[model samples]
Target: MDCLPLHTLQTVFGFHAFRPFQEEIINRLMAGDDSFVLMPTGGGKSLCYQIPALHRHGVAIVVSPLISLMKDQVDALRENGVAAAAYNSSLGERDSRQLLARLHAGELDLLYVAPERLMNDSFLERLREIPVALFAIDEAHCVSQWGHDFRPEYVALGRLRGIFPGIPLIALTATADHQTRNDIMERLGLADAQVYITGFDRPNIRYTVMEKRKPFQQLQEFLGTRPDEAGIVYALSRKRVEEVASKLRELGIEAAPYHAGLADRERSRVQEAFLRDDIRVVVATVAFGMGIDKPNVRFVVHYDLPKNIESYYQETGRAGRDGLPAEALLLFGYGDIPISRSLIESGTNPEQVRIELHKLSAMIGFAEAGSCRRGALLGYFGQRLEEPCGNCDLCLDPPDSFDATEEARKALSCVYRVGQRFGAGHVIDVLRGSKNERIRQLGHDRLSTYGIGAHLAAEAWGSIIRQLIHRGYLQQDLANFSVLKLTPSALPLLRGEERLVLAKPRIKVAEAKKEPRRRGTVLNMEYNEDLFQSLRALRKRLADEQNVPPYVIFSDATLAEMAALRPLDSEALLKVNGVGVQKLGRYGAAFLEVIRQD
Candidate 1:
């Protein structure tokens, strides 16, 4: 029992060692202590609890918010030869009864459930009758109202400690800021839990935010280089989801739409297809990506701006979950700001609205940032990167910044002259001296700042306005039809006491670049391409035969290891990184046959 974690890691999960903070967190949990884990997506958040659950006495109960995630994790665990089961609303009566019987009989290693189900009195009584090992709560941020994906069901989880006093509990989340983290701890009543924030930086993901220039065309161009790769495209509306999905199909890409507007069965089908790799791309809204566990998503493209940085980070975090090189492309324009603002303002909670607005501003700052994108992103999470990440758009080809003091002043003056109530477009029109009838009718043409900005084009002025908004000089008042309002901070700029240096809007071509190297691989090792492809084909065949995703069989990194270290027999094959005892018995023969042929 003392060596169970190491045994499980090597014989079941088939990893050489634990990731940075996993071993520590697992040890604490196995010691019958509560814990809080803040690891990024694909950072092995599951293993921290799964391994401990195996090490503990009774069945480990994992509270997850999404049914899809529950099934995916349970499937992956079973694939690793762990006796795991998921009980949720999706299960039939007979299935639920059998699972409950299994729980009573203590025949399961792990049991995944929803937070709502865990709060039931009958469930608590049933749990009390059995010796529960520990409670593992995934997506713990859902307990905090300040979190991006707030679910009311999560609030009831506070009773877990009160109900099962001696059982250890672990709360896990991939995204949480300082405020949200505090709220999560207080809400879950994990005051004495050992908190581990493993870091927010996903170095394998390359962040690229582009101006939305012909969005569909831009999307097609972005997808041109990633043929047959799995990814997600997020739009702002259901209409856009359908439009993008239809267009992707027209272009002969295997794509589908998933949103709240779709029927539950249709949505389930789409999600299952995606998990099975039947669909390579999913065009969706914000509703699509909370609990997905697909490991090999190669890219995540934001067709519109996400309302807050948390949402953006969580959405982008869905990619590269396999610890491979992934891309996050955000196609933003001024129009997206208003749409996101309106969505945020429509929410019922005032305090929540204010917090969301502030987050939106920070997200805009990331989009309009001149420096490192990763720096700004991680800075928001309270983690500082010492240097440029060298993977984002700015680090790859640094954008130039211009001293736009006069231009900013001119833009602010124009907003002020237009009664400070016009949106960016109307103000841009006034600044650029457009011969529009509305400007003439409003007599804004007579203002001193009317044509003062004509030296710059309307697009240029719009860029300046966006930059001002990002820099805290101006606030887009969604309550006032998204009119530009000068903040008190803008006084310094208006008084000519501050200079504004803004990054110039990038002009990009549609050509593709070379693919980035996958992370966690030895770059210096020369591999036989033929052998790698052969192994991949075998993996796909095995995955298809098992009716599971390819990565479930073995990750590309595992296959690369197999290709580089071609072993002759099972004894040598078992020495590979991902080949645990179970996998060696299940898949070693077929894979060894390929290597032996080579």
Candidate 2:
């Protein structure tokens, strides 16, 4: 094997070793073979294509979905001393002409473009005239109809394989289930490509789902612990996004709102501010995070429930991208279910609606999961954990359990006595013996099961019903108004042949005490907090002067390592991780000065 890739990794990108399958994927690309990569969010997926772009004979064409994503990747590459540029609508006509000239002159290492532009007839004709090294499709899951964020424009990317049969192509994504994975390959015409799944576990992020009581208060309490850290709070609607941003700002938290309804310039300004650490929090709809590349986000809070597991996973994966400890707090509420169902059912495509409802049911199951949260999440993606992940809320503070066999039988029987046609709310009303008009009109009050559960509160019964649905004793037919139905598994439980135990309903979010720090990476050694902050101040000054994001100069992980090791000179500083030759030549002296003074 050629050693140039490894050499480039060390001197250019400043990495010591390959992350898991990175080296193998790069080798295959260099050998002119197509590949598919399914790695988690922070799993170094970019390097798998980036290093190959540097070594290939011609400019590598990267098909990106968002202009912001293209710009971030190009900026980071240029900071690492690579000749990269993005051809997007944001560029002026003169800049676009210059970029094309450079592309034709072979003066560029990588060229990033959107899928629509790349598939244009003129762009295809122009590419035919140049020496193209390889093509990379980022956010590849968008090509699949089954993916959470599908785009019809991405389906046109399949033509690239036929147009450039000789040049290698690679497609990559952070989230794809079994069906989405196969659909991506089939849609992208990468059926013969090498597939690499590097697992779906993000152990550094602690998962917690609160009961959504006093939601804004729960959010305030959660944010109180980490007042200075940067994070994103995702809401399902623009109105809610604005409301949350206003409320947070009223409490003196530096925050801003972002949604599609905002003006383009305003959205850009807010994004730029957040990237530069000028804003501590961004409360936004789902439209805000797909293009962000910031790495120091310490937490991600779902102010409202997401629509499906894919959306939830992708949103939460935004935190802890730097391999540091982070948190994902989800405010799970029963009210969010009807809102989400209505949104999913409004679509005209019947098949699409069915798929989305199935996904929604899975999301509800995950939220109501009694076992390890990590186990339930991974299990949805077809991976099983032999033991429980000890980092989630359930693992940290176990929920109180009780013998719920009697309650389970009661809830299941209520579903049956109602002819298994009513939804959870109506079923709960009958169980609690409500004198509502619907109960009286349907004559459900005459049934024996009507007043059997009157002694228990409606909230208690809601918890039991949700648990039954999650445990496979009940299923929801989302297409038919989310009516309750009994599965074969309910028969045994209804016959009293087996007993059940479940977690008691929790109303308030538990405050987790700070844990002792663990050794993360090899360079995650003990560091002085004061010195780290000093170095961070210096980094911010330099970043502001250069008009680039602070992480573009050096990530927080690098600063922590420098503070821990206390490198005194250029030679010593060069020994630190993430200190590439280009960066050492640029910012090494300034960082070393701060360390020496300390």
Candidate 3:
């Protein structure tokens, strides 16, 4: 049993068994084979490599992109009673030399390094002198230029096969489409690797997208409902990050801002504070989230739309990493679309620009979709859900669609009548037959389509315009000041050859429903709130004493299990999902005492 991955899983990681695909991946790796894993964030990708590292004869070399992530994973491994160390820019020369000495001496079971360090000729020469067990490339998607978080250094990983011939190399990532996956395999030279495509659905995270209206206010309302819950607020720019963080703090929330523009030390401090739960929320640009290993992030709020669906999926995947119920809220508007589109269009190559635009278009479709959000999101990744998921906003509150064929025709007529040069506002103005000076100046009031849409309110017209843009019936000339222009698809609709259906717009925020606690929470039982809070207090105190994040001691899920099951002794405590031998030996009594008193 000691040679079994299941044994290592229980004794070291405190789970009863390996998660789906973990055992298979570990088995293959132990047999000195390569693998390509695409499991979701909380799906136990780490254990796939860590177990093999332990079972193998020599130290496992893990190549990662971010220093922060390397440190976080190494710390978690050490906490699990594994000898792990990370070498990165954050370490001083003395510390680097010490860790390298240990690595060479085989005192470290796993050594994490950036791809740059791994690809360094000197570093590779040093590694050649040691007995290397295996090579793991985390965030394998980075090797693919099509992948959202591509790093040029990741392309160097293709050399590992030649450098360490016959050594098993496993590439792992949480997000990759079909094209990106192929690119990753080609780049890593893992064409013969066993490909494990675990389903990409994160059932624990409730997906919700809101129409961005007074975003800060909407964000405030969203955060107000979940008090004391840790979350990440993602903005699109550094200035917005500061503004949102300031606003959140002004509203009495413990928030911090993180971006690349900040000094490295300040960014590190903010990230460390966030990991330790010193901040309740972090307003960050895209720079902050990739390497974060914080498992208790209760929510991830996109204050603006992400660049594409891949970025959205990966960022949202950060939540509920501990297998607890979490939420992902994305607030977007038609305004965010052009900003993202321009960024993509500004790319150098025509083909790359086309690909990016297509990606942005898909993201916009997801945002404006009136169908099951989960289905649309997964569909983009080449996975199909057999039925509507009841976890997302659309499924929970289905919107009503109506035949708007006549409305579509009229809107198209207005766009055409306005010379297809004006934006939605001017078109709407002409449709409403507004006698405003601007319309008079443009002489649009005299047009045949003028006053044709007077039966509908201005806000209604706005929703129709947005839907048209999203539905591809019309394309906004983002390069030319947001002018409304017709795509070829609009031709049929305008000529009455194709009927159109549009969802009735939500005029106000949906009433917040009191959802029953998710079944995954505390093993789906009505646990004692006081007991859960007390357990958290104890965990915080213990974590503070050890100078580790509370989750490094035990996750919210573990404490929830303790609160619900009321484990009275070390034996019972060890049976909890997250309580392993190492943690049970260290903090079992303290947690057992808390449960015993109840």
Candidate 4:
């Protein structure tokens, strides 16, 4: 039962410390206790298992939902000098046998497996023979029938406890409400397990819920400021993923497409490039999560609304993993909802579809909400926040409030004047008094309020429609592709029957433009970028020459400090993080000379 402090292990993993609730969970599991970890993505749940797995004696059996995720964790573990392997579909019989031999021979510390493989009679017999330390279930939320991502296999995973009665089990998921959490415990036969619930708020990620007007334009506007930052653009379909990736590439971004449709090699290449920071953005579907481990991702944009806040939180949580400031910009509209509904409904039973759709609609309401996106997000997870996060679109937009009853009445009148058959676009055109040929031919220009409301712009009418829907004055017809319909609430505005004060478009916060080429500053990049590369080579060479790991010479953290500050002396390098007097004497002069040559 000997152990190192959690903080010490965090530093060994190249991190400063555990995130909130991470240490508590780690201590629980490290004490040989069963626990359920309900943590959001980017919430440091990995460390909860990883840290304890390293400190524990026997090999940790990690039950992952996907082979991709298994490979990712194994690769990351090996990267940090830990022996880990996975027996899955990706491996041939030889590899699987080799991995099993290693595990049984006590040569490996961690092993990941798909649930079906673990359920096999032969696999279970083999696992029983091995000295299993702790049983870890990743994506534990999938066990719940109420969860959106219910996998029957996950439910079967609970039988593991019955099979291996003495093995301590730890279930983990990034996106689960209390009900799902409870379901996971009950289903996994760990109802009395220590429950660790981390707060769902990610303040580092700026929550943005924009009206889905010209989603491409919205995407471009956001990227205009952050062209160089790495990000993920989540779409609902493979076609949309390809289309958005193509469009972003056309816009001169280093973008790529990812989904189950792409070849495994191509997906692997793109994933590698994204991890290496070679690509700036990845346009993908929900298939892109779980396996992703890269930190320092600056943004995550969702072109289509996610089906639930759980999905939304997990996807957005991918950004800002390094505790740095990032943005979660999700573009959504009423049209995206039914597409999700129909997809799930057509494939599943009627009752289950109904329940899933209801959850989706509630999530959409949050997207269209004018209040704090963070507050709405936390509230959905059953966690209460005391204040609106000032970083979201609603907080930033701070729209102007006025009596929209008269305008709403005029807008609905304008829609009615045009026969109530047209969509929001055509209706907005008429409300803003546009003189297109369709308007002229339809003769809606003759309406009393048509030219009278000429002061409003089309975007303004768009804002009005968004607010109308948000206020429940307008309903989107799900039977159609979200055709705007005047609800009973709209009747007050239509006849000036009741008063309603609503905000206008908030002040546009002009974001700084992206300068990929370093517009204002000019320097010899060979000396700048190449110099940093050369320093890395020197650091590695010095480390090898001294017979120690590179960090033992000076960490990458110190190397970066030397590059950024271009420290030319030993004393200067000492000021860098991780640089100490002992190592300063060992390798400082060599690095200083590398920079001095510049």
Candidate 5:
């Protein structure tokens, strides 16, 4: 029993070693102690609990957030020859009854359930009669109001610690900042649990942001570079999702639209098709991608700006899960900011609105950052990167900088002259000397700074003001109609005590001087492209026959390894990273035949 975890790792899950904190986490759970894990997506978070479940007594109860995610996990576990099942709304009456019988009989190793179902009174009573192994909560950030994707149902999960006193419980999430992390601990009553924060850097992903000019054309140009690759295009509205999906189809790309507006059955079909490689792209609102477990996504393009950095980070983290090079492209348009802010302000809870507004401001700062983009992103998570990541747009193609000492003074002065009670629009208007009626009616025309910036265009002035706000020289007072107010740091610049330099605002996408490396290509070793494609086709066929996603049979990363290693016999095939005893018996022969022929 002491050696069972490593034994299970090789014979069942097929991994030779544990990732950073996996073994320690599994040990804590097995010893009947609670834990909190903050690992990135595709960082093998599930295995931390799954391995412990297989080694412990009775069935491990996993509280998942979505039905699709539950099914994907259960499917993959079952493929690995584990007795795992999901009890949810998607299950039929007979199947649900049988699953319950298995639970009562102690015949199952794991059960995935939604938080609502697990919290019901009858379910609580039933669990007391069984020998439960442990309780696991995935996406634990949903329990915190500070978390971007807060769910009211998840708040009730705090009761789990009280309900199951002796059983070990573990909570996991891919995204959380300092505030949200503490909230999750308090809300879930895991204050004494062992906390593991593996880090937030996904080095395989390249982050790029471009000003939104003819966005559809930009998306087309981006998609043109990587053909037949799996990706997701995120939009702000359902209408935009449909529009983008339609346009992509017209261009002969295999694409589909997904949003809350779509029927459940239609959404399920689209999601399944995507997992099976039937759809090359999914144009969706933020509603999609939370439940998707696809590991081969080569890219994720934000058609509109996300409202917050957590949302943006979680969405982008969905790509490059397989440890392959992927791209996260954000089309940042100034127009999207107001739409996002209006939606946030419409919330009835003032506190929640305030939190959301701050998050949005941080997100804007990331987009407007002139230095390292990755550094800015990680800084928000309270982790500092010592150097610029050479993968982001700023690090790759550096932004042009110009001394803006005079421009900064004019912008800060206009904010002061406007009584520090106006938003950026009115400030920019006064700076550019607009003769609009509101400006004249407010009698702001007489101010000395009113026409000081008249030589610059409205866009240039807008850029300067935004940079000042991001640089902490100015702050947006969300409580007071988001008016721009000068910060203490603005005094020195206004008094000619400091010089300022800013990146010339990028209004258009920069053309690459050389052809960039194709995304989703293996970086470590060169694999035979033809053999990789053949192995992929074979995996797809086997997955279709099993009525599961292709990744359930084998991930693209594993296939690439097979293509690279070119193992010709069963003994050598078992040495591949993903090939465990069960997988070796199931897939080794089929893959070997292809490798030998090639």
Candidate 6:
């Protein structure tokens, strides 16, 4: 039970590195201690238990929530020559027997099972017969009853140590708000465990929020700007998921829908398709994306507002997992406020529902705030920043405002003249002097200020209406899909007693600009870096031609080797890990030609 061998395991795992606090967590577990790991997504949580399992005798039991995640991790480990197996409901009785026999024989280093199966009496008996190395609970936050995703069976896991006395246990989660953290310890019986909390700051992701009128058109505008980026769009309902998926397909974006309502096999297919990059955007509900392992997703957009901030944080975390730049865009409005309130109000216990509603309200406040979105988000997570982060929508595109005492008075008067029963579009038409049939139907043409503020464009007027909602000068009637309704705060602007300054929303795209810097560890090579890129381009070309994954021809390791060695002929190239005689003869010349051009 020690980490004297962990340094070797790092190299064995094919990672030239580990994150800052990985070893600290591993060392605690190696010493037969308990631990609660709260690292963010893609923060090297798997290695904490996988490496330690190799050091101890017998198999380590890894309880995972998703069979897909289990299979992917096992496949990846086996590819790197590690022995792993999964025993879940998916396995046939025969396969389960064989897997159990293999476990008894100590043939597997790690065994992944679902929490339901882990609680089986026969499974526990089989496990006890074999010397248990350790027990790992992935997605441990689900064990907390107070947590957003509480699974009933997870409470039983806290008593596992009593069943296998002296065996170590580790709990890991990508998200645990303060309440969930406390619940995890109490429910999992890890009160004495060491806590490892990687702070919730993901500086690489620039958070942006926008208020929308026609969501479908706005979605197209957003994706059309970054067609090359891989992203996900989250809807609130299964019907909306399918609708958005269809719309994106019509717009010529490769997209798919994934929800629990889909067939299990179809769901698996979509999940696998996304992992293989066969689809660029997955329009899913909150029902999807818990244990997903896709590391290259470049952005995450919420077509509808999430129920709470913790859900928002965890789902957005799936982006930029590879430590690359990413974006999180949320489209929300006052309609989402009551939707969350209804969901919370309908829960079983009123007190619990009220508590959850409070959390949801905080999320709504963060979404609509005029301050920096990141600052509000960090503050909700108990983090404080003395200065505003210059990356959010408020900082990057500072809203433009003029002394709008007159404009505010005119807009409010238009709403009042129309009796305040209409939506934003109607309000904007009256202000912009667009006397269409709808305006005539409402008899809004007779208003005194109807054509007085025709100086502003329709888009400009839309920006004013949204900003007014955000600044509390006006409120939206959610029952009317957020129709314009003046709040008490609107009186000052109407009376010319106070200056009202509101800025137009940003309607632009960010350019893809990168600063030059050296990559992670330079191999000792003389080949031009541009030529190194050329080889990679050819590898992708060959992979597409052969209809196989690029890694099958050459791994990143092999590419780095080529960049270091810059081999001249087949003899030197054949020595690379993935370069058998077949690879050298089949695809060697194209790579060599690119290197020679350097």
In terms of TM-score, which candidate is strongest? 5
Tens-place lDDT digits, model 2, residues 1-598: 1458989998888878889999999999998999999999989999999999888889899999988788788888988899999998999999999999999999998999999999999999999999898999999999998899999999999999998899999999999987789989998899899999999999889999888888889899989988779999999999999999999999999999999999999999999999899999999998888857888898999988898899999999999887888899999998999999999999999899988987887787788776567877886775657677999887777778899999999999999999999889899999888999979999999998998998999878877887676566787665466689998889999999999888787665454445764533325478887888898899899999999989888888888888888999888887777889999999998999889999
| Model 1 lDDT tens row, 216-333 | 9989988997785799999999998999999999999999999999999999999988877789999999989887888778899999998888889999999988676789999978
Off by over 4 Å in 1: 2-4, 401-524
Error of 6 at 489 (Å): 30
Which portions of model 2 miss their true places by more than 4 Å?
Answer: 1-3, 401-524
Which residues of candidate 6, in runs, are more than 4 Å off?
A: 1-6, 399-598
CA error at residue 301 for candidate 3, angstroms: 0.9
Candidate 6 per-residue C-alpha lDDT over 31-83 given as tens digits, one digit per residue, 9 for 90 to 100 = 78888888878787888988878887778899998898887777656654568
In terms of lDDT, model 6 sits at 0.74
TM-score per prediction, in order, is 0.83, 0.84, 0.83, 0.71, 0.85, 0.72
Quote the positional error of residue 53 for candidate 2 in Å. 1.0
Instruction: Work out candidate 2's RMSD over C-alphas.
Output: 5.7
Itemize residue pairs with steric clashes in candidate 4.
400-503, 400-504, 409-493, 409-494
Alpha-carbon RMSD of each model: 6.8, 5.7, 7.4, 10.3, 5.4, 11.1
lDDT string for model 4 (1-598, tens) is: 3547544453345444456777888777878889988876667677788877877878888888887678667765654556788889888889878888898898877889888888889989987787887889988888997675788988778788898878788998878865677778899999779888877777778887666878898898888977557799999999999999999889899999999999999997887677655688999989887647665577899999898777888888889764556788877777877798778788557767666675676576566555456766775665656665777766765554676676777777776677657667778877777889998897888877576566888767766675665555665443243356676666756665678776655433222232243211112112255665677678657645644334334433345456667777766666654454445555568778888997
Residue pairs in steric clash, candidate 5?
none
Better of 1 and 6 by lDDT: 1
Candidate 2 has its poorest 10 consecutive residues by lDDT at 515-524
Clashes of 2: 0
Over 4 Å off in model 5, which ranges? 401-515, 518-523
For residue 503, model 4's alpha carbon misses the true position, in angstroms, by 7.6
Candidate 3 colliding pairs: none
Q: What 10-residue stretch in candidate 5 is worst by lDDT?
A: 511-520
Question: To one decimal, what is the Cα RMSD in angstroms of model 1 from the true structure?
Answer: 6.8
